[model samples]
Target: MKRVLIPVAFLFALFAGSGSAAAAPPIPVEPTTETLDCPGFQVDAVYTGKAKWIDAPVASGTKKRLKLFTGVAAASTATLTGPAPTSKVISLSLNGSISWSIVLSPEFDIVITGTGRNLISDPQHGDYPGGLFLTVGKVSWSLNAPDYPNGGITGPGSVTDVCALLAP
Candidate 1:
């Protein structure tokens, strides 16, 4: 009886220590900022998003699953500068649904889809007011389980020419 109890006690101690040591800690996060530069254009925006852990916290690692969503009415606006010389300014509006998974982890992934809409503008060529207008379809991009330090996001489609009078 004594010999059997000794082995059982030792096994319990070993298991307990291993379990405590293998646990991971939760990862703290704050507001993050990201910049996206389009061809001939640049946009700077803040990420106001919400994140929730899918499981309990650990002591040496982070949560394996996380669900994230963009904040209410979170949007990014920028000015689209046309070709050189004239350097015409076109108001650019970007609204979308952004969701992330495995956030703050190496397996992090993101999916973003911009709400499609027409470009807002009021320009004149020659002597016509409101002679320039353009429309852009819904644009979407995503970052799947990408390779570390070498992942690439998809690009948006080209803008359609709706203002023939302002053609240069």
Candidate 2:
């Protein structure tokens, strides 16, 4: 019995030293102020939400939806410095049926509602690398859109990377 216990203890020690049992680092705390930027637009807005981890086999998964305060979007981007035109969302939906997600890892889904020359039109569809950057406190994550022209938007006119405008 002593010999068996010794081996079991040794195995446990070995596994623990191997880093398999190591605790995951604490998730980054969300910041009070959030800023979202795109190639041709930028918005510094206040968000109300929290990010939490999701159960998974391996790797950490976080899902977060930050709803921008009403008028914050317009107030933040009041001055347009980028090449893209001054854009605003007449109506935005980032909760309920539609929500924006920023995953620290590689997979995430973010959705917003707005229409502009260089912004996400109605019913924007994307896979990964959706050209979205969401800043939560000090940590930030970039959500990729599908690899395609005009952010998978049909019809004419240049609609390239309009999703970035919706980040917050």
Candidate 3:
């Protein structure tokens, strides 16, 4: 009985300690800082657009905001990979005589347009937006699981502008 109990206790101790180590704490690790420098190329043609809409403010007694929509087209063969991602904003006029002035608040909002993919892309394609991203394309963009929560939440909170730019 003593001999059997000894082995059982040892086995229990080994597994009890191992379980804690296996369950790692959930802390986010920052991305690597190493930069990639790629040669630049001139674009022949380009097309892009952006739009944002906001509901009444979430908190108390805030003025209602507006939405933004802009588009552009460009035809060029620009290589789109480098140490850091590049981005640009295009502006569109409402073309109306409204008296209220609308401004884009620099807060982060998901860009839900194909022509303006600079905001997010498939992780496999090296265009994954870390905070929240949805796979608009039909390919594997990352080795790990893709993020899907932000896809459900929809609202333009801080953005107050719609713009676009395309050149040949």
Candidate 4:
């Protein structure tokens, strides 16, 4: 009895002290439509996706969880369309995958991975209004709020302005 209790107590204490919350069920990203102002026309976009939400207070040794969202946008896609003054309705890839996940470190630094949409829109500062980014491999980016002023992105993926493709 003493030996059993000893192991049990240790296990309980370890988990109890971790200060981490259990992962929640995946959140369904419902289909939504939005219009984006392009250079000369308006871009109508339909977005759909899902994300497995997680909340971890702290990790084992580092003081924060290793990762939170895993199934986030693992299976996601998007559709975009634009007006055509010169021709009929213009459109890009009817269906495109836009999978991505966010990771928070001990220092609270955010790292986003996978192919998806990225926009650092700060009214005070200039923003990078990037549309769909597709890559053969994988794409990742480090986010710093104050860093983006002129609107830019540096990564391995090829950026496709859905608006441009649909524009006439």
Candidate 5:
């Protein structure tokens, strides 16, 4: 349930082009390691993958849309630091493909389809649950602002609490 998306999103921003530039073509992501920010501690995530740009942002429209396919193999390990401290090797692994559609209209919106991990850390909406979830099938989330990690999630699908595997 740890981010395959987090790594992918990083690559996305690198390959992503803004207005006046169409989506970049398929780019292979070199194997790399990145630090992941979790609720309590941090994890070192290593991954290799590729993203194929399917749709460029609409050239002219109030709504900007982008589509793409991504597949990655990601794994992570870390020690819980804030609470529930453990010496056990906190680890997670994921290999999967996903389709993502991002839009900007009234707000920056996203819809991801396929199987992967999603972190929901938004905690300001009246009795909302916050955690990292291994979401299978499909899940949708919206950020309060672009490039923000915390956001609210709402969708129907199989959800697994990843902390159980990583720490508990």
Candidate 6:
């Protein structure tokens, strides 16, 4: 019994010394920079185009939109960096005038669902969710105005007008 117990203890020690049992070092990630092509539409184009008025004239300004591209490159270099999770809806309105353009760049709550992709144009509302579908690629998303809930169509103070100006 003594001999068997000693051998068991020695075997346990031997297994414990195996490097494989040790935790592996955390993988180091390098910081990377990537540009999401706006496709000249989205927010950037909306600001560029619009009609001017007096009382609440639409201001004129340059707007730009960017979507992150995916794959190994699309993956964010910062392992744990991104917008804080939120559920509130974001609103974007550009009041354009001949001389002035109102530009609002709000950080939207977007979810990444379905196939993994870099950029995806949300079909429903501008409040997009999902990681972005790779197959669908980059598409145009509609921004429904809060002040004026005009269904899916664009109306006064709507993203539709801005998209029209951005039309490529």
Per-candidate Cα lDDT values, in order, are: 0.29, 0.26, 0.21, 0.36, 0.42, 0.21
Per-prediction RMSD in angstroms?
Answer: 21.1, 18.7, 23.4, 14.4, 7.4, 26.5
**lDDT at position 9, candidate 4:** 13
Per-residue lDDT over 1-168 for candidate 5, one digit per residue giving the tens place of the 0 to 100 score:
112233333343344332222334434555555544444544444444443334333455554766644432233221222224553343334443345667666556665554554232232233332344455545555433332322333456566554444552
Task: Give the TM-score comparing model 5 with the true structure, all chains together.
Answer: 0.49
Candidate 2 least-lDDT 10 residues: 1-10
| Per-residue accuracy of model 2 over 33-135 as CA lDDT, tens digit each | 3333443345443322222222213324443443321100111111112232444442222211111233333434433322221223222223223233211
Candidate maximizing lDDT? 5
How many collisions between residues are there in candidate 6? 22
lDDT of 5: 0.42
Give TM per candidate: 0.29, 0.25, 0.19, 0.46, 0.49, 0.16
Off by more than 4 A, model 4: 1-30, 37-41, 48-58, 63-66, 74-76, 84-108, 115-132, 145-157
Best by TM-score: 5
Instruction: Estimate the lDDT of model 4.
Output: 0.36
As for TM-score, the candidate ahead, 2 or 6, is 2
Per-residue error (Å), model 2, residue 152 = 7.0
- The count of backbone overlaps in candidate 5 is 0
Model 3, 2-82: lDDT tens per residue?
Answer: 000011111112222222221243222221112111113221212122112222223334434332322221111112222
Flag the better candidate by lDDT, 4 or 5.
5
Query: Which is better, 1 or 5, measured by TM-score?
Result: 5
**Candidate 2 wrong stretches, greater than 4 Å:** 1-31, 59-91, 96-147, 150-168
TM-score of 2: 0.25
